[model samples]
Target: MRTVADALHDRHRDQLKRSQLQAHPLLTGCAPWVIRRVAAVADEVLFPPGELLAEQGRTPGWFLLIRSGVAEVARNGALLGVVGAGDHYGEVPLLGRGAHPATVRAITPVHAWVIGAQRFVPLVDDVRPIRETLAASLAAQPALVAAARAELASRIQSMRREGSNTWPGIRPPRRRRSVRVLHVLAAIAMFVAVAVGAAAMYHPPYAVIRPGPVVDVANDIEISGAAVHPIHGRYLLVMVHTERPTLLSFATAAILGHHRPVEHVTALGGQPDVERQLHGQFTKSQQDAALAAAAALGIRPSASGALPFTVRFRDRDVVGPSGGLVYALAIEDMLSGADHAHGRTVAATGAIDPAGDVIPVGFVDDKAIAAQRAGAQVLVSPTSEVYLAADSGVRVVGASSLREALDRLAASN
Candidate 1:
C-alpha cells in the first residue's frame, strides 16, 4: 500500500530512532519516536581537543549525544569509562536533582548534539508505552514497589480529604530537581527576616556620638540637704549608639566620622562588662560633678555630710564617661544658681576623674558637628583638637577641668 520512497523514508526514521535509543541503556524501552523527536530539537556543537564537556556533582542543564571522536568520563577524580560516537552522557540532573556520577571531557576533537533538560522531559512524557515499561522495571524491585504503593495510597487519601477524587495537574520530570523553588524562596525570605531582626536587636561593634538631652543635674544632686538653684543653660549629654560594625559598617561609620573600635570595648573582657564599666564611669562622674559644682558654688560637700543624690537619666542610653564636664556644670548651676550659661545653649564632652579633671574622649568631631547643627553657642572639649561643623558655625572651647568649663561657660555668656 506504500510507494518505495515512502517506505524507505519510514524505514530510515525507524532505523535512526532505534539506533539512537538503543545506544544508551536508560532509553532502552523508550519508543523510537521519542528518540526521533529528541534528535529533532537538539543543537549541534563542536568541541576542540582537551575540552571539558561537563563536570561531576554539578546540576546538568543539558544532555550531550556524541556523534564523533572520543570523550573520557571520570568519577570522584578517578577514571571511569570512555564514550565514543553514538554515546550519550548526562542523566542524573535530568532524572532528578542529583549530582552527575562523572565528569565528561573531550579526548579528541568532538562533535555532539546537546538537548536542554527542559526540552527533554516532555519527550519522555509523550512516550506512554516506554514510561509504563520503565515503571514495570521499577515495580520489579519490592522496596520501590512498596514505597510507590504507599505513596499512591497516601496521595489518594489526601485528595479525598480535600473533597477531590481526581488528581490535580502535576508537573513532571517526576525526576525533577531535588530542591523545589518554593523551598528556596522560603529560605531566602527567612534569612532576610533574621538579618533585619538581628540588626534591630543586636548591639553594634561601633559607637556613635550625637547630642543628647540637657537634663537638670540638680534633680540628681543637692547641697546641704537643700535643692540647688536651676542652671540656666541645660548641661549637654553626648549620647552614643553602638553599631554592629564589620569592615563595611566600620568604613561607613568612619566616613561619617563616628566609629570607635571594639578593641577598647573588648579590653574589659566583653560587651556586657564594657557596658558595666561605662555605667560605673558615669556614676563616678555624677559624684565628681556634685563635688565640683559645690566647690564652684562655695557650697561645701563636707557641710552637707555625705552629700549624695540620685541621678536619673530620662534616656536609658547613657553609655560612656564623655558627659562628665556637662554633668558637673549642670550640678554647679543647680547648686549655686550662677546662671553661667545666661540662657545660651551649651554642650560638652570629656571623661572626668574624682578631682573633676576633664579627660579627652573619642569621636570629638562627631559631637562638635552635632552640637553645631543644634545651634549650640559653645561646644567644649578637653583637648585642642577641634572638629568644625559643616558650616563651621559652632565655637570650639577647650576645658581642662570642671572649673575651666564653668569659667569658659560664664565668660562666653
Candidate 2:
C-alpha cells in the first residue's frame, strides 16, 4: 500500500504534499480555503535526534504537526509518551492557558509542519474547527495524552524494527553525514544570532555627544513688541546631539574617534524626560536672552513690568540653553540697528542669565566642531569653556558676559 510519504513524493508541489500529509483533526471538515490559509504560512522544519521540539515551562512559539519520525514527550524527566507521524503538539501553550507542561524531544530524525505563534494564534480565533479541536484536546489532555503516547510509542517501535524512518507506510530516505554538519552549522548560527541580539538589547551606562546642526539664529528668531530691523550677519547656534551608546555605535565611535562618551548621569541629568526639561530650559533661555540683550542695549524694564519685547526661537528642535549667548547676540544685533557679524558667520554657545552673564555649557568641543563645519569664522563661548574648544580651525573668543561678548565681537571686526 502506498503511504502518505509516497503520495507526497508523487506530488509536484510541496505545499499540496504538506496539505495532505500533515493533516490534523482541526482541518477535518474545514473549508478548502481554511486549509489553504494554514498552508500559506506553514513551514517544514527538520529536527535532528535529541533536538527539543518544545521545552517544559516555556511558552510554545510554534505549533508542530509531525510528518515523519518519532519524538519522546517527557514531564520533569519522566517519559509520558512518544509522538510520530500525524501527531500534533503545542496547541495548549498557544491557547494562553499556560506554558508547555512537558518537553518534546526528537528521538529520531524528525520532519514536521511548523506554524509560528504570530500566524497560528489568529487562525485559532478565526477558524472554528481549529479552536474547537484544541479546546477538546485541552479538556481531555491528561488521559488522552497517556493513551496516545502508549499507542504511538508501540507503533514507533514497530516502524523502527521494520527499518523505516517514518510511519509504517513510508519508505525511509537515504541518510547522509552532511545532515549532521548542517545541523551543527545551524546551531552555531543560532548561538551567534542570540549573542548579537542580547548585546543590541543591552543598554550601556554611557551616551555619546556628537556634533549636531549649526543653526543660524539671526534669520531664525522671531522678535515682536520691538522695532525689528533687517540683519546682514549670521549668529549660528551650535547644537550637540546625544545618544544612548549601543555596542555597535560605541565600537564604531571608538574606532572613528568622532564622538565622545559621557556618563548617563551627565548626559541625561537624571531626568526621565530630558527632552522636555531641555525644551523648558530653552524657553527660559530665550527669556533670559531677551533680558540680557535689553541689559546690553541699556534698555531697562519698566517699573511696572519688564520690557514688552518678546523673543521666540524658530527651531523647536533645539532643546537646551546652549544657544542663550547666541540668542542674546542675535537680539542685540537686530535691536542695535547694525549687524555685529558684518555679513560674516559667528557661532556662540553658552547659557545666559538675565544679568547678561555668559554661563559655560558642556559639549563646547563638539559645538566648536559644528561651528567650524558650518563655515563660521568665529565662535563666542563662555570664558571658562573657551579652553575646551579643540583645534577646530575656527577662532574662539571668550566672554564672561553679554556686554563683554559684544565688545569682543566688535574688537574682532
RMSD each, Å:
31.8, 27.3
Query: What tens digits encode model 1's per-residue C-alpha lDDT throughout 16-135?
Result: 545644544455555667667765667768775456787765556787777554566665666655665556665434544344546777643466768787876675577676446445
User: What's the true lDDT of residue 412 in model 2?
Assistant: 90
The TM-score that candidate 2 achieves is: 0.50
Candidate 2, 228-268: lDDT as tens digits: 88777788989877788777677667679878765453235
TM-scores across all candidates? 0.43, 0.50
Report the C-alpha displacement of residue 347, candidate 2, in angstroms: 0.3
| Displacement of the residue 238 alpha carbon in candidate 1, Å | 1.6
Whole-model Cα lDDT of every candidate shown, in order:
0.60, 0.75
